[model samples]
Target: MGIRLPFMVLHAKQILKSTSQNVHNRNKYNVPKGHVAVYVGELQKKRFVVPISYLNHPSFLDLLNHTQEEFGFNHSMGALTILCKEDAFITLTSQLSAS
Candidate 1:
C-alpha cells in the first residue's frame, strides 16, 4: 500500500523541489540531477546534498515539519534549511540510505 502524506507535507515537498530546481537551473549550486541541497544545523549551518527520494520517507517528512515550524517555507537562504544538528541529520539520512 502507498503512504498518504498530509497537504502540508506535500506542499513543503513541492516548494523544496521547486527551489532546488531553480538553484540548479541558475547554475548557482552544483546539486546533481536527482538530488537536493539542504542546509542542516542550529547555529552554523552545513549543507548536505541528498537524494530527492528522501522527501518521501516518513522520518524525513517529520524533519520537514520541524523545519516548517522553525524556518517556514520562505527562508531567505533560497534553499531548504532544516533547523537541526548536523550530526543528527546525518545520522537520520544515513539510516534512511542504509535501508
Candidate 2:
C-alpha cells in the first residue's frame, strides 16, 4: 500500500501538469472539473459535458471504440466526437447514470 502512494502521486502530478497546459481551453469552455466535453451526433453534432468517470465503463468504451474506428482521433471539432445519434448518446449516458 505504501509503495503505491509515490506512483499515484507522480501520476497525479503528470495529470495536473497536462491540465495546467490546457487551462486556457478549459476556461474558454467553462468545463467543470471531473467532466469532459464530447460531441455526439451524426449529421449535426451536439456537445455534452459528461463525467470523466464514464470513460472507464464498458458501454462508454464501446462508443469510444466506434469513434476511433470512424474518425481516427483527428476530430475537426478539436474535442472527442462520438459517432452516434444524439438520442443514442443521451440514452447511454442516462443508463450509465442510473446504474
Candidate 3:
C-alpha cells in the first residue's frame, strides 16, 4: 500500500501536468473545450477530479470567492461535502466520522 501510494501520486502529478498543458494549448488556440483531470490518491478518498476550465468559470469562481471570504480558504476535495451547499450535513458528518 505504501509503494502503491507513491506510484499513484506520481501518476496523478503527470496527469495534472498533461491536463494543464492541454488547457493551455486549447486556450492559446481559442478552443471551446474543457478537460477533466484526476489526481488519484492525492487525498484519502481515492481521487480528485475536476474540470480544468471550471476553475475559471464565472459561477465556480464566484462560489470559490464566496467560500474563501466565508471560510478563509478555497474549497478542497477533502472538504467538498463539508463546504458544498447541496451536501447533506448529517450524512457528510457521519461519513467523515467513519473515515
Candidate 4:
C-alpha cells in the first residue's frame, strides 16, 4: 500500500498539467470549427471569429479588397488585420446581422 503513494501523486500532477494545456489551447483560438478568425481595430488590434459566410457579403468583400490593395496579399502579421475603428466594426457587423 505504501508503494502506491508516489504513483498516485505523479498521476495527479499529470492530470493538472494536461488540464492547463487544454485551457490554454482553447483560449488561444476561441474561434470555433467552421469559423474564421479575423483581427480588427486600428489603435489596438482585436480578434473576432466570424462565420465563413461573411466572405460572400459584398461589403465584407470590399473591405478585403481594400486591405489587399493597401497591404498586398502578404499580411505576414500572423492574422488578417482589418484597419478600422472598433466602433465602426461593431456597427457594420450589427448591421450585417440585422440584414
Candidate 5:
C-alpha cells in the first residue's frame, strides 16, 4: 500500500506538469494579457492584437458576427479569424485605441 501511494503520487504529478505545459504552449499566441490576436485580411492574412475591451465595442462585435457567419466558430487555422480587409481592421482597432 505504501509503494502504491508513492507511485500514484508520482503519476499524478506528471499528469499535472504535462497539462500545464500544454496549456502554456497552446496559449503562446492569439492570447495575451488583456489582448486577443485576430487573423485579418482578405488574401494576404495578417495577425493583429487588440485589447479585450474592444470586444465590447459595436464595431468589433460586428466583425465577430461576420466571423461567426463565415467560419461558424470552427476555423481551419484553429484560431479566431476576422474576414475583412486589413485596412478596415486597422481602422477599427485604431478607433478603439483613440477612446
Candidate 6:
C-alpha cells in the first residue's frame, strides 16, 4: 500500500491560496490593459485567466519560489509541470492506472 502524506491537504490549501491570489492580482492590473480576464460560466462559476506572459510576472515568480521552498524542489517542479500540462498529464496518469 502506498503511504499518503498527511500535510498534503495543508499544502494544497496553501497552493490554492497562493495561485488564487496571484490570479486575483493579475486580473486587477492586467484586465485594464486587456491582457487578462476571468472565465465565467453560465452558472456563475469563475476561473482565472492565466496567460503565458504571467509566468514571468513578479507575483508569479514570488509564489513559485515560496512554493518551491515550502514543498521542496522535486514536488514543486512536478506540481508546476502538471499545472502547465494538465490535460496531457491527466490522460497519461489515467492510462497508466488503467493498466
| Candidate that scores best on lDDT | 1
| TM-scores for candidates 1 onward, in order | 0.76, 0.74, 0.33, 0.64, 0.66, 0.28
- lDDT, each prediction: 0.76, 0.70, 0.39, 0.60, 0.62, 0.38
- Backbone clashes, each candidate: 0, 0, 0, 0, 0, 0
Model 6 TM-score is 0.28
lDDT of 6 by residue, 1-99 (tens): 012232333444454445446765556434343223323222332444344444344444444444445544344221232222334334433553454
lDDT of 5 by residue, 2-59 (tens): 3433343343234334434566545665246666556787777797777767765777
Residue-wise C-alpha lDDT for candidate 3, range 1-99, written one tens digit per residue: 334333433443454455456655447434233444322221233333354444444444444444444553322532231134333323433443454
* Model 6 stretches astray by more than 4 angstroms: 1-49, 76-99
The CA root-mean-square deviation of candidate 4, after full C-alpha superposition on the true structure, stands at 17.6
Q: What is the lDDT of candidate 2?
A: 0.70
What is candidate 1's lDDT per residue for 17-87, written digit by digit as tens?
A: 67755745448667777787888888887889999898878898888777776667676666678888898
Q: Cα deviation of 16 in candidate 4 (Å)?
A: 31
Give lDDT tens digits, candidate 4, residues 7-94.
4334323433443456664687665665566678766888876776665566766666665556643344355567777787788778
Off by over 4 Å in 3: 1-48, 74-82, 87-99
Weakest 10 consecutive residues, lDDT, candidate 3?
Answer: 38-47
lDDT of 3 at 93: 33
Ten-residue stretch with the least lDDT total in model 6: 76-85
Clashes of 2: 0
Off-target runs (Cα >4 Å) in candidate 4 are: 1-27
lDDT, candidate 2, 20-50, per-residue tens: 4787876777767877677888888888988
* Cα error, candidate 5, residue 22 (Å): 4.4
RMSD of each: 3.6, 7.1, 14.7, 17.6, 14.1, 14.2
Task: Count steric clashes of candidate 6.
Answer: 0
